[model samples]
Target: MAVSQHASVRKTVKEDLGAIVEMIQELADFEGMSDGPKLTIQDLLRDGGFDDGVLSNSVPLFHSFVLELTEQIRTGNKGKITSCSSNDEPLTRTTIIGYAICFYSYSTWQGKSFFLEDIYIKPNYRKRGYGELLFKTVAQHALENGCKRLDFHVLAWNPAKYFYNRMGAENLTESEQWEFTVCQGKKWMHLPKTIPSGSKPLKS
Candidate 1:
């Protein structure tokens, strides 16, 4: 099926956290990691600058974008359309179908870069160009913010890698042997003391 012409992408607001987290779980389930997602709506609110406690002028730790389509496009989809207007004049209800999460990072060799933590479209919504629309939207956001590079990781077996390749993304793991690593929980907490005391700082 073709993507709805009324589909649109925009920066996420505080209200979008619930839908975003739900889709995050859906993506995890699709990847065969149903228990992988550990984020909560409170976390998104704080990290995305939607929490009132967060300083208004401070840059958020992350940014998100969501893709929405009007109710007319989701007519027969069970449990997809949540609310509708009382009037009969073409229900203007919208539903969040996809989302992208991103954060900025610095590269000593390349300056500013943007990292796409996740991007996902509903299973029923895939193959209709919505994923590409969301991906391009994130890329444009990166460019507008002066990012020189956009980076993300895809599982070696994921078919989405082909889509990314078509969009001109490079596989650094294959081309440059760049491996992704992570440290969390106790390991991350102890990382500060792991450095040798006598280690000398390298000159910049």
Candidate 2:
């Protein structure tokens, strides 16, 4: 599907916070995300909308429309955005259809740069050109930033892999070169100490 182009993509501000949060919940329900409600409206407002907060780190200023799906259109109801922003920009609604979120990262193996994240469209709003718009928006941003690649992982169950492949994304049969490691809380205390690094076992 060729991406349908859009004329403007602007930054969102504090005023748009309510709508953003609504969308977050909508995405949680759509994705069947178990921890959706775990994130409350106050969490978003305090961490993101306020100065020096979680929103500042996790979401971009005005372009954090990460989840895609225009459920409101198909359901004949209004959708929401479940986050906050620095600017109160008007939420541009165009049968939102879907959303995509991406950020910059370096590929130590390839010695280049790329994007890693998800693009989700509401189940009911699929194939309405909203997905295309989101993809195009991200792709253009990737190119503009001089990134050599734009990539994402799609689950086998999604069946969107076919569409991604058709859009020129290469699939690997054996991705043995890549390995993931994350440390949090107790796990973070187990590793060797180097420059403020340590992983210690928890006390009973």
State which candidate has the highest lDDT.
Answer: 1
lDDT of 2 by residue, 29-59 (tens): 6556747456554554555444456445555
Model 1: residues >4 Å from true position, as ranges?
A: 1-5, 54-57, 73-88, 193-204
How many angstroms is residue 63 displaced in model 1 relative to the true structure, after the best TM-score fit?
Answer: 0.5
Error of 1 at 145 (Å): 1.2
Note each model's CA RMSD in angstroms: 5.3, 10.3
lDDT string for model 1 (1-204, tens) is: 123457889999999899999999998988899999999998888778898865443778998999998755333443344453333223355889999999999989899999999999898889989888999999999999999999899988899999999889999998899989988889899887888988956759
Q: What is the C-alpha lDDT of each candidate?
A: 0.85, 0.54
68 in model 1: Cα distance from truth in Å? 0.3
